[model samples]
Each structure stands twice: as C-alpha cells, then as structure tokens.
Target: MQRKNSILRSSKRGGFAMIMAIILIVVLTTIMALTLSLTSQTTKQTSDLYLREQAVLLAKSAAELALLKVSGWNRATSGCLTSVNAVYPSTTNKIFDINVTMKYIGLGCGGSADYIPAIVTPESNGTVLMDVTVTSDPGVSTEPIRYFRRTLQKL
Candidate 1:
C-alpha cells in the first residue's frame, strides 16, 4: 500500500511540473513579440526625422539663391531690372524641388495698385520681396516633414 501511495505522489508532481513549463514558454513568447514591435517603431521614427532635416536644408538653399539674384540686379549700374528666376537641386528619398521668382516694381508714382509689379521692387523703393515655392517630387506620397512660407522684404 505504501509503494502505491508513493507512485501516486510522483505522478501528481510530474503533472504540476508540466503545467509550469507551458506557462513559462507562453510568457517568453509574449516578451519577444513586444520587443520586436518596439524596435520597428524606433526605426521608423528615425527615418522620418532624417527626411525632415534634409527638406529644411533644401528649402534654405533655394531661398539663398533667390536673394543672390536680387542683390546681383541692384549692383548692376544700368539696365532696367526685370523679373528674376531661379531653380534648386533635386532632393533624394522623396524630397522636393525649390523654385523662386521675383518681379521688379515699376512706376514709382503709379497710384493704381494694379500697376504695381507682382514682386517686391528694390528700385521703386529700397525693399525687395521674393516668392519661394518648394514643391515635393511628383507622385511623392510622404507628408512634408516641415513646411515654411514667408515674405521677406529687405533694403
């Protein structure tokens, strides 16, 4: 009778051990899944930040080029200043092209606002204003990481 009781006890202990092993496996699997998900999220955020930085740099370069054109015109002693045009380099990883245009204001005393040039005029007044457009590459679905638009008038 004692031997039979010992055998029953051994079987109960084995069943308990099997249950614990199953539970441990489940817990480990869950932890691994969470870790992978976190890693993926971190990678995606890094890519977005890098792309945004590039876009800002591209835009600034375009603005500088436009300003150069304006200054160049003023330095020229003679010749009726007209419109200015400029283009910027292409961006990679779905960035955009920068375009700038400036029109010279004519007729200092033209009372009609319609007669005023579309762009800021340094000749009529000392202030020159420019319009800048940074357009994303065609068919690029990525949302612009950043967008900046301003009218700058300088003497």
Candidate 2:
C-alpha cells in the first residue's frame, strides 16, 4: 500500500508540474507579444513626431523668407505684396509646399484698407503680418503633415 500511495503521489506531482510549465509558457508569450506591440507603436509615434517637427521648422523658414520678400518689395508700388507660394528643395521629388500670405499695416502700402480689418492692426506701421504654411507632400512622407505659423515682422 505504501508503495502504491507513493507512486500515485509522484504521478500527481508530475502532472501539476506539466500544467504549471504550460501556463508559464503562455504568460511569457503574452508578455512578449505585448512588448512587441508597444515597440511598434512607439516607432510609429516617434516617426510622426519627427515629421511634425520637420514641418514646423520648414514653416519657420518660410516665414523668414516671406519677411525677406516683403522687405525687398518696392514700397513705391501701389499694390501691397500679398501672397507668395513656393516648394522647398525644388528637387524633382518635392517634399514640402510652402505658402506665405502677408498683410500690411500703416502707411505707404495701399492705405492698409486693402487688407482685411481682422488682419491689420492700428498704428502698427511697416508691420508685415506673415502667415506661413508648410505641408508635406505625398511623394515621400508616410502621412500628410501641415504646419502653420503667423508672424508679425517689422519691415
């Protein structure tokens, strides 16, 4: 009887060990899968953030270019320099679309009434209201990114 009882007890222990091993394997697999999923999501988020930052930088550069253009504008010309649009890099493969819109305030530039009242501020002479928009084109970017910047610059 003792021998038989020992044999039964050993068999039960082996079965329990097998079951525990299977559960442990399942838990480890789940953890690994979750980790892989998180890693992929992090990669995508990082990519998106990088693209957005690039767009913002491009917008800022476009704003500066707009300022330069306005400063060079012939003030004697009755028409205010209103809009400018160009693409960055100018390569065969275009990357970003930049659009700059300017509104002027005070004298010399068309009485300033040609600009919308909401855009022009009173007593702000020689101020160039620069609105810059930079958009990532579909040719290279995985997703479309657009950044807009408004600047008040003294000409």
Candidate 3:
C-alpha cells in the first residue's frame, strides 16, 4: 500500500511540475513580447527626433543662403529681384530632401501683404521671406516626415 501511495504522489507532483513549467513559459513570453514592443517604439521615436533636428538645421542653412542671394541682387536692374527657389544638393537622397523658396517683399517687390503679417509692414529697404521644407522618408514607415521653417529677413 505504501508503495502504491508513493506512486500516486509522484504522478501528482509530475503533473504539477508540468503545469508550472507551462505557466513560467507563458509569463516569460509575455515579458519578452512587451520588451520588444517598447524597444521598437523607442527606436522609432529616436529616429523621428533625429530627422526633425536635421530638417531644422537644413532650414536654417537654406534661409541663410536666401539672404545671401538677396543681398547680392543688383538694385540697378529694372525688373523685380529674382527669388531663390531650388532644391539642395541637386541629387536626390533616399532618406531626405530639402526645398527652399524665397520671395521678395516691400518696395520694388510686390506681394508683400501676402507674406508679411497685417500688423507688420515690410521694411523700407526690403524684406525677403524664406520658406524651407524638409521631407524625410523612413523606409520602414508608411508615413513620411515633413518639416517646414519660415524666416523673414530685412534686406
């Protein structure tokens, strides 16, 4: 009888161990899945932030270039000053592209009211409004990232 009882107890213990093992596996799997999800989200956020910063920097550079172009304009010319509107690098990048558009305002230039706020008038010398647009494509993502920067400068 004792030997039979021992056999029954061993079987019960074996069954319990199996159940515990399954539970442990399930818990571990859940934890691992959660960890992977969090990591992916963090990586995406970091990538987006980096792209945004790059766009901002590119915008600033484009604005400076616009200013230089306007400064070099020959006032003696009869026609309106030529605005700068072009893409950077000329060659396309798979990741990002930068576009710069500059419009002249005030004095010799028209369409000042469209760009300049009603509260503020264009300077006597002149004003140049520069709009820089940066677009980035993250290959893995379905949506593309776009950043726009507008700068107003008195020439």
- Flag the better candidate by lDDT, 1 or 3: 3
User: Could you give candidate 3's per-residue lDDT for residues 1-155 as a string of tens digits?
Assistant: 35455666676898899999999999999999999999999988987787777777777886788678668766567444445555434546456666666665554444432343232443434776777787765662456778888887877
Ranking by lDDT, best first? 2, 3, 1
In Å, residue 116's CA in model 3 sits off its true spot by: 8.1
Q: Rate the local accuracy (lDDT) of all candidates.
A: 0.56, 0.78, 0.68
Best by lDDT: 2
**Per-residue alpha-carbon lDDT of candidate 1 for residues 22-126, written as tens digits (9 for 90 to 100):** 999999999999999999888777776776666677666666766666667544454423333333343345356665554434423223322353446445564
33-111: candidate 2 lDDT, tens digit per residue: 9999999888988988987888888888878887887777776754678888988778577778899988766644554
Model 2 misplaced regions, further than 4 Å: 1-5, 8-10, 75-78, 107-113, 116-123, 138-143
Candidate 1, run of 10 with poorest lDDT: 106-115
- Ranked candidates (TM-score, high to low): 3, 2, 1
- Pairs of residues clashing in candidate 1: none
TM-scores of the models, in the given order? 0.59, 0.73, 0.74
